[model samples]
Target: MDEHSTAAESINPKHQALIDRLSTRRSATTTSSDTARPVADFLSSFASSKLSIEQSLSESRSRADLDHISSLDLDQSSFDSASSSLLPRKKFSFRNKPQKKEEDPKNVAEISVEPSAIDKISSLSVRDGPGFRNEKDTTLVKDFRQCDVGQGEFTLSDLENCRVYLKGTVRALFFYRIRNCQVFTGPVLGSVLIEDVSDSLFVLASHQIRIHHAKATDFFLRVRSRPIIEDSNRVRFAPYRLTYEGIEDELKESGLGEETGNWANVDDFKWLRAVQSPNWSLIPEEEWLEIADISQCK
Candidate 1:
């Protein structure tokens, strides 16, 4: 019994000495002094970043438990395939920059025949701009007087038997396939393009005007230059009669504030004679509409 007791006491003292040595090593490795503060801060920040990264990864996707893992068993192709969907995407903001579709050059009126466009018209897939489109028997009014209207273009297409009121100056304007419509607008800073219009009345002010394939239409224009026409007949022109609140300011800013009298100078590509073109004629003053009061339109 004494021999066993002595052996146990000796074994305990050796174990105790080894424990003291390990505790001394641990204490020496700990950092607390002011001189070691930078090291402590660096370690703390590194730990915080690592924790945040781990939390983000865990929230996004589940990971396999690695606690019992003793060897790597990753499949390279599977890893790539799984991670590909987690990649970042390109940045976009539609408010600042609108998405613009590619404009087909063949869609230009001068280059293409109208009869061959039935198949292409279905594929045109009208892109939404600042104006109305694809309407039948509807009344549409766009009051852009409160917008930065000069920065963007307006489009009106495929409309039939409609009344359109466009208020405020714009960068440019486009009209296509309009029929039996009464259209009025403020000044256009750039040019105006019209195509395939019939039996309509237009009151507009613009820097330039071009008409194509129009029939039995009437125009009241405050223009900077002579208007041109192609494949159009029985069209009549009159002085601009549009008026609205703040329209003078809008027109002044677009450089069309005053009457230019160029509306009477009509140029028809189909009529190249020295005599006046029979296609378009100036409307008599008696038939002119009274000053259009569109202020109360909205």
Candidate 2:
């Protein structure tokens, strides 16, 4: 019994010495001072030291009980995996610059022109008779079938809740700030431009159609080129469905007699992606209206 006690005393001192050496090594390896170290880092260090001490105690127990130690084996890989998962994540940062605000559309239009420019616009000649402008809650009709060949451009501006009809060929068509209106026109030999229109319906044939800042509008068009739009949303496209007396001759003269089927090939300048643009879509056939016959409007 004395010999056994002596052996236990010697083993206890050796184990305590080993624990002291491990503690000293851990302190020496630590780079950050206690004042500068984050709380999370300090906690991680404490956990690592606690795990080492537990491992040392288990090893000492194994030396004392060989049969029990043989039945228990430590998994180093699993321990490392658990430790990695428990570690705190690093911080992230964003460095984007602030963007400038866009100008108001109403204010931009009010200051878009100088006094001299306004005068110049007023002085411009309309040899093909005056085009409709600033009309509201009224029906305006122009029968171009009776007019001469050199029909100039037509303008529809600031019209609200109005119905406009034009028969026969025209050089160009321009529409601005027209709301809740129905505009049915004959073939246009040149391009058509529409801006700031909302809740409107348009049926026309043109070489090209360009729309900007329009919302909730539907276009029934026969266009020779791909129709384009910018800053427009909730707009739908369908084939032209207008019929009138001598309309075939007018369409032939304007090079729009054949249905090119380009009306649904819309190009949204704001959307450039492989998927279809959300701003425009083909009108479902069930929702399409009957062919508009304006021959009786006169």
Clashing residue pairs in all predictions, respectively, total 0, 0
Per-model TM against the reference: 0.58, 0.57
After best superposition, candidate 1 residue 291: deviation in angstroms?
Answer: 1.1
lDDT of each: 0.75, 0.77
Best by lDDT: 2
Q: Once superposed on the true structure, which residue ranges of model 1 sit more than 4 Å away at CA?
A: 1-128, 148-150
Error (Å) of candidate 1 at residue 252 is: 1.4
lDDT of 1 by residue, 1-298 (tens): 4533443354445434533643453345444454244334544553464455444433432223221111122234542343233222234667668668877777876556665544443345444676788898988888776775555898999899999998877888899889999999988989999888899999999999999889999999999999999889899999999898899988898899888899999889889789988898999999998989888876
Model 2: per-residue Cα lDDT at residue 86: 40
Candidate that scores best on TM-score: 1
What is the TM-score (0 to 1) of candidate 2?
Answer: 0.57
Worst 10 residues of 2 by lDDT: 66-75
